[model samples]
Target chain A: MNIIMSKTITYLQRVEFGDCDPAGIVWFPNFFRWIDAASRHFFIECGVPPWHETEKTTGVIGTPLVDTHARFVKTASYGDVLHVRVHVAEWRDKSFVQRYRIERVNPDKTGDEMTLIMECEEVRIFAARREDGAGIRALPIPAEIRALCS
Target chain B: MNIIMSKTITYLQRVEFGDCDPAGIVWFPNFFRWIDAASRHFFIECGVPPWHETEKTTGVIGTPLVDTHARFVKTASYGDVLHVRVHVAEWRDKSFVQRYRIERVNPDKTGDEMTLIMECEEVRIFAARREDGAGIRALPIPAEIRALCS
Candidate 1:
């Protein structure tokens, strides 16, 4: 079987004072915010059209997360710059797996040294307005969009 | 082996305007924030003192999440009232599993009927300041705290 490596995209994020909790560390939920942004950046970088544009043609609203698993590795504080590396780990019939590795860039490093802060994996589906208009429904992976991302 | 059933605690949360995303649904990360608060409320309702008070005697700072897995079942928007039911699912030597079931309260319902919104399971550790004070370290589950919670 031919193995195709998924393209990796890196998104930059800066830890702000409001992102930290009373512990003085970046509150864990903020990591999810950055990861969500990174997920969008990955698709945009891969040349996929914005969801609004795609919606006109395919009725696709957006990719919505259905499940997620995360592990907190190290703590981060305000003033730290984080690099969120993201990619599509796997593709399924109606859903896909997106993975992220967040790292803090250390200025004192001799070169390009960074510390791993957190890691997350999420299952998301391309959603469209439901028939009754009450909610959203998953759509099969779009061939054109998948081709662009893969 | 003997089994002990943990006391279940429910925390109330109201969806705020800022909690919703452009899709008009609760941004997924905000769910984690509510779950975290519910986790703390579980201990408090179970007769455990606040972390600040426990810190003085046991050096236990707080229960910090180490790993978490969550599944989003339904969408929620502002004006929705959520009931977050939380409980300790399992106890380990250094870490414990917390489970949460978030449901949306519907006024039209006859009784306590509610709609399921999300489910989450988290692994957290009782943490204390490390000797070097660089970061937190997991402490053995405090027997007294465990006794109270269980």
Candidate 2:
């Protein structure tokens, strides 16, 4: 018997004029915005319920980012169609490494070729509402969620 | 003789409702958005012209992020006033380290101090429009820009 250890999910987005800055290219922060959305989408695609639901069932409020590193390889502008591919790179005891690769699809006669725009690796934690309710704290990686994602 | 090597600039922002997530907390990506704005505001406060103007005089378009590391210490919500303090942590030949500290101020008479929401350190480059006009390329630190930021 063979078992798949990890899975990748793709999230699509259309670049809009509002996403660009005065330089006529996508503002860097917009990339992070899409990445965050993609992160959630990955979980959804893996059959995980929304954070609100998980909050009550497992005391997991959400996955809050602990650290991130990103590299912008190319620039994107309005009218571009981007595909954000997300996956869990590693599952730690209390945190996991979420990785993303954003690409711009170029449609041509020779078929579509994807241009690499940016890549990022982030450390995130499944968080539970703090006892005092002031903020959140990291929770141990849930077995059910990890099994679904894997 | 003493020389001031770096200067810090603070940018003020009002947390808007749309900036929050379904959890009623400021979404993480919005932090990056404000940091980007604060980065630009820092240069503007230091007397650097806007990127469009600098693009004409010097081929410099804008500072683009190459690498970044951030930690979220506390969560924020709508109706809060945030102060983002930005400064240069290191000056490289072709890239510089820009640092940011975001704080939520509590102005009650009880003297409760401000809360640190997040902190980030980003490696960015002085970007110039590529000769091929496709994307941007890193440029050596311009003396005038360095002098202003310093």
Which lDDT tens digits does candidate 2 get at residues B30-69?
Answer: 8998999999999999999999899999888899888888
In candidate 2 the C-alpha lDDT for residue B96 amounts to: 97
Clashes of 2: 0
State which candidate has the highest DockQ.
Answer: 1
At residue B100, give the lDDT of candidate 2: 96
Given candidate 2, what's the lDDT at residue B22? 69
DockQ (0 to 1) for model 1: 0.79
- How much does each candidate deviate from the true structure in C-alpha RMSD? 2.0, 2.7
Worst 10 residues of 2 chain B by lDDT: B106-115
Model 1, position A20, has a per-residue lDDT of 85
